[model samples]
Target: MSVSLRVLDDGAWVSVNDSRQVSVSELWRLDAPEFCSCTVPDFVVENFQSVGVDGRTITANVYGQCIQCGETGVPGWIPVGRLKNGEYVDLDRENVVLPAHDGHEN
Candidate 1:
């Protein structure tokens, strides 16, 4: 029994055809006791030149290995956002189908 997801749809993920893309959720890892001010990982937008503000969300790209297989298959993505209390939030979603970067056709 496989379940599907969608954006502006229902559940955690949105289904587009046979594949599904879920809005990744992340919990910010605060090094300091204060939540209002925290540092984010670099990979979470290292490729981008600027950091844009989107409502309460701060989008970024991150890198990590698969915990299960220990394979460097895909780099994890981090979705950062600020809470009403000024605390930062970050969540890591694994195995995201990222855009192809190689010269080969996608």
Candidate 2:
């Protein structure tokens, strides 16, 4: 199976299969100590710098600010969603604490 992943609208949205599936301005809980010192940084999504797929997981290199520590940068590839049977499935990004993937399996 194949999926089309793209960063669109000047890095404001993540287009999956040519359709806008994710967007900026969302509050995401992150477990990224390398990006910030906060135990669980309250990340505010500002841009979708890039997007890729790791197996069934859909990941994104996002540019955002940590509301707790005010740290801003790309926290590596963060899992934004997943592919189930070749269909994109949205993750509960806002409610869950997403871990940043630095190219290693997690």
User: Which candidate leads in lDDT?
Assistant: 2
Provide the lowest-lDDT 10-residue window in model 2. 97-106
lDDT of 1 by residue, 12-104 (tens): 332232343323232223222111222321112222211222344443333233333333222322333333344344324332322212121
- Clash list (residue pairs), candidate 2: none
- lDDT per residue for candidate 2 within 1-106, as digits (tens), equals 7788889999999999999999999999988889988999899999888898888999999999999889999898899999888899999999999999787422
How high a TM-score does candidate 2 get?
0.95
Native-referenced Cα lDDT, model 2: 0.90
Give the clash total for candidate 2: 0
Index of the highest-TM-score prediction: 2
Count steric clashes of candidate 1: 14
**Where does model 2 exceed 4 Å of error?**
104-106
